[model samples]
Target: MRMVFRWFGEGNDQVPLQHIKQIPGVEGIVWALHDIPAGEPWPTDRIKEVKQQADQFGFHIDVVESVNIHEDIKLGLPTRDKYIKHYITTIKRLAEVGVKVVCYNFMPVFDWTRTELFEKLGDGSTALFFDNEKIKDIDPMELVEKISSNTSVTMPGWEPERLKSLAKLFEQYEHVTEENLWSNLQYFLEKVIPVAEQHDVKLAIHPDDPPWSVFGLPRIMKNRDDVERLLNLVSNPYNGLTMCSGAFGADPKNNVPDMVNEFIDRIHFAHIRNVKNKGNKSFIETSHRASDGSVDICDVVKAYHENGFTGYARPDHGRHIWDEKCRPGYGLYDRALGIMYLWGIWDSLERSKKVEA
Candidate 1:
């Protein structure tokens, strides 16, 4: 596995590139042009600017966390073709700069949702939490304000501009169902995947954050069968998945290691983090250690090793530790710690293989 760190560019992030480079096994940054709005083609100069900054720190910007798909694309609106053209252009530019994988999602309205950003954990370190009961009761607008209120850096799924049209977005999806979402996603893949293949870049769709429906929004990519169906929708290597342990693990039914072994070839990137599942469709982010969370992170790592996975992977959402105030889930200390945990697993697997041989 090639480990990368998600650096949200200079000024926008508290953790700098130098700090990321100091992490032992991290060789690259998973990045994007955050200031650029979704559906707009990213400028070549801007992409190069990020590349130059990572170069200065001696790190490769090989994976992009997202080139966010517009709601028009997800809703299958008439204007989707224009946004798709812009997306295709962006893909070509990213590939020109040696980006091997582009991690994007097709979830409508919100990219991911949670009732609370800093739910207090037993250990005093806080984590991103989801309360099933509370989510059912709370208004999504209030939740949006809660998530986007304190930070200058844009949260991944809760883009400020998109949330502004919450009422309209919700109304747009009123008639849409799970099947509609799947068809729309397939439409998007058909248009974008060929361009991705031409550019030698794989489009890795991140699974729905909780791997279930929220606020009555239809979520299709929530299980192994969903992932399999998606891969077969386009039937191309460039059309793939960004298999996230924390997202899929929320479901409890998803065996992440087994999925990794099954879908190894289609996995272009991975978000290896852990979550402690609470009963009845609720979970909270936990330390990346296998014992702390529901997902068997060691087995996940070992599966990757056995499969000879050389694809890019990163420590996903982490706890807000050491009083290091930053983005809710994208803090430095815990993620750095998570990386060490992952490295420990990978190293042990390598040694075990040698011993067995």
Candidate 2:
């Protein structure tokens, strides 16, 4: 497995590219143009600016965490065609910049939701948290305020403009069901996957954050079966999965290592992190160490090694350690630690192979 780090960009992130390059096995950055709104063409000049910056620091800008999908596309609105065309244009530009995989999601309004940004753990470090009972009782708008209150850094899914119309978006999805979401996602894949194939870039869809419905919003990409169905919907190698462990692990039923083994060939990107489930559909992020969390991260890594996975892998969400004032889940200290932990596993596997030979 090839390791990469997630960098938000020059001024937008607290962790700089130099720090990322210092991590032992990290060879690239999983990034995107966050300032640009969804459905807009990613300007070539903007892409070049990022490339130039990464080049200065000696890191590849090949895999993007996301090119955010517009609500119009997910809702299947009349204006979706225009947005999709713009999306196609963006893909073409990304290909020009040597991007190999473009990760995007088809979730309606909110891309991911959490009740608390910093739920303190036993070690005094904090992590992103989701309380199921509280989520059911609280209003999404209130939760939005709680999450976005820290304006120091930009949250991926909860953009200010989108959250402004939380009620309206919810109302729009009144009639939309799980089947509707699946159909809309299929529509999106049909149009874009061909372009992706032509450009030699893979279109990877990130699974829903919690792998379940939230605030009555229909979430289709929730489990392995859902991923299987999605892959078959387009039935092309270009159409792939991001294979996020934290997201899929929230559902106890999802065996991440098994999913990795089954979908190994089609997975182009991976977000490997650990979360400790609290039972009854609740979970909290934890250290990337396998024993600390619900997911068997060791088995997940071994499965990738056994499958000969050479795709990009990055440590997903990490605890806020050392009083690091950074993005909620994307902090430097713990994530850097997570990288070393992963490297330990990879190094061990390589040695064992050498001994056998």
Candidate 3:
């Protein structure tokens, strides 16, 4: 597996490429034009600017976290065609810049949901935590206000501009059922996948955070079965997955390593992190070590290692360790430490193979 780091941008991200460069085995940055709104065509000039920035640090701009799908497309509205055209344009430009995988999600309204961004653990370090009861009881707007006001850096899924019309967005989704959402996603892939295939770019859909319905939003990409359905929906290699262990592991039934092996061919990117299942559909993000979390991260790493995975991988989310004041899960210290832990597991597996040979 090729290791990549998620870098927001020069001014946007607190963690710099200089620091990320120090992490062993990291090959590139998993990035996107975060300032660009969903469905808008990503400017070619801006794309090239990001390329130049990555080139400075000898990092490939190979994977984008998202080219966000517009709500019009998700709701299957008539105006979706315009947005789809813009998405296609963006995809073609990203391919031109050598971006092999574009990671996107189909989760309705919110891309992901959490009760608290910095829930304290026993170690006094903070990590992203989800409380099942809190989400059910909390008002969506209050949750948005709580999260948006907490951090200046825009969180990946909770874009402030979209949430401004929280009431309206919820209204739009009132009539959208699971089946309707699935059909909408299929419609999107049918149009976009062919273009991605032609340009040698893989459209890797990220699993829903918590991997289930949150606040009544339909989350289709949850487990192995959902992945099977997704692959069959568009039977092309370019139409792939960014299998996130933390997302899938939220539900204890999901065998993350098993799923990794099962979908090896179509998994274009990997977000390898650990999540401690807190029962009743709740989970907390943990360090990348297998021992720290419920997910067997060692086995997950081995699953990819044995397959000789060539796809992009990143240590997905991490705790805010060392009292570091940074983005909730995308902190510098813990993630850097997580990288070493991942490298340690992978290298040992490699050594074992060599010894056997």
> Against the hidden reference, what TM-scores do the models get?
0.98, 0.99, 0.99
Residue-by-residue lDDT tens digits, candidate 1, 1-357: 899999898888999888888899999999998878889999999999999999998889889989999999999999999999999999999988999999999888888888888888989999989999899889988888888776667787777778889999999999999999899889999999998998899999999988999999999989999999999999999999999999999999999999999999999999999999998888899999999999999999989999999999999999998899899899999999999998988888889889999
Q: Clashing residue pairs, candidate 3?
A: none
Q: Per-residue lDDT of 197-234 in model 2, one digit per residue for the tens?
A: 99999989999998888988999999988999999999
What is the Cα-based TM-score of model 1?
0.98
Instruction: Point out where model 3 deviates above 4 Å.
Output: none
Model 3 Cα lDDT, one tens digit per residue, 182-291? 99999999999999999999999999887888888887888899999999999999999999999999999999999989999999999999988888988899889899
Measured on C-alpha atoms, candidate 2 has an lDDT of: 0.92
- Candidate 2 stretches with Cα past 4 Å from truth are none
